[model samples]
Target: MAKWTTENPAFVDTWFSLFRLGQTKKQFNAADTIKMSELTFFNPLSSKDNLKIEATLIADTIDKVFSSWGAKLENSISRNTAINDMIQILLDEDKTIKDLAEKNDENYFFTNEIKLENES
Candidate 1:
């Protein structure tokens, strides 16, 4: 099985923490200060089935979070440029997508829609 892990787990946690804070404030204190590396995702895609599991896991997380807070979230992740870029980062790479399509020990994918919905 593949797992989604980040070298900077604290960064990820803090990022989400800010998001929650923004939710309370009705606006992010420093929107422009937030960032994620193009290569933020760290995982070993050992097989297509495993990768699918990872993607599905990501999707499920989003579904659970967004479904609960859909109104507050307003569901803007799909239209986000960062999300699109992350998808591209997954799809544009023949190696990554192919590995994701089947399975490669070294593949990375970032799901923006999957990322946001779960944060709520």
Candidate 2:
């Protein structure tokens, strides 16, 4: 079977998630994945559109890692800028999106059991 692609994006519940972090080692660790998965900052179920991501960019959020990405999907320019700005986060020795999300989330959104896809 083919892997999931952006053209046919997967819709995920805000309560649980499994996403890969860039530049990070994919070696699974139970506690670390839990911390990353629990972050409300990256929750895909946002009702917010044209989001100003900076307000949420504090201690434990993806925006903190890419502070230049202040605007959201407002326009092609903004989208391109934000996407380009994201490249900075991949720089070595810089704090990562994984670092911020794993620090602690506000937990304002959903909270429920998150299990590995392989689990029965």
Candidate 3:
């Protein structure tokens, strides 16, 4: 089983601390920054599975929480571009889609989607 584990206390503390801060702020702050040293241990380029899990969690939250708030988050280009870039980086590292695919017992799939057409 692939799992994400970080031994860095500073990284975990700062992340959740900022998340708590954002939960109370009336205006969104985009100036949040991270230290390079702190980020080095969890580099997406060096940890494909970690990046995939992070991306999936962000996606799941957006789908379950933000989908009903006007526009669905999955329709945003920036979100898709970020995930796509991660997928490309994983491919560059020789990680196949199958390796990242979510498993269902004995089977695995990249994704499952349903598109409804308009009946006019």
Candidate 4:
């Protein structure tokens, strides 16, 4: 994606909001995907447009990652730029996770459900 700029003010605003939502939510659902679909340049579900496809992927990812894990900062850029930055961040995170998995067994990070002992 091209660098995000202020030229697309609407996209910028929407992304900013989605980014913030990631911080407060434990997980996003299909409803969130529908909401972010509003950012698409065309009808994402029905249209085969490239912009629409990109928009759908972005929305799906936002929902999947819970809004960039609330890592959005006050950076000035256009929609494309924002997308680029987000992809970069996610890639970086993936790399770290992969490294950790390689260091330990595949289930290294997968543990059983948390158990809380009685405080009383």
Best by TM-score: 1
- Could you tell me every candidate's TM-score relative to the true structure? 0.29, 0.24, 0.28, 0.22
lDDT of 4 at 17: 41
TM-score of 4: 0.22
Superposition error at 23 for model 3 (Å) = 11
Candidate 4 backbone collisions, by pair: 3-81, 4-77, 4-78, 4-81, 5-77, 5-78
Compared to the true structure, candidate 2 yields what TM-score?
Answer: 0.24
Q: What is the lDDT of residue 62 in candidate 3?
A: 30
Best by lDDT: 4
Assess each prediction's global lDDT (C-alpha) against the native: 0.32, 0.28, 0.31, 0.33
What is the C-alpha lDDT profile of model 2 across 1-120, one tens digit per residue?
A: 222222211112111122332323333333232332343343445434312252223222333323332212322334334333432322212333343232212221112212222355
Q: Per-residue lDDT of 9-119 in model 1, one digit per residue for the tens?
A: 222332343345331121223322222221123234446555445434443343344335431222333324322333343433232321221121122122443465589
lDDT of 2 at 101: 31
- Kindly report which residue stretches of model 3 are placed more than 4 angstroms away from their true locations once superposed: 1-27, 30-46, 73-120
Question: Of the pair 3 and 4, which is ahead by lDDT?
Answer: 4
Model 1 stretches with alpha carbons more than 4 Å out? 1-42, 72-120
Error of 4 at 101 (Å): 24
For 29-69, candidate 3 gives per-residue lDDT tens digits of: 22123322122223545566775665455334433332242
Report how far off residue 17 is in candidate 2 (Å).
10
> Candidate 1 has which clashing residue pairs, if any?
45-104, 47-103, 48-102, 48-103, 62-118, 66-117
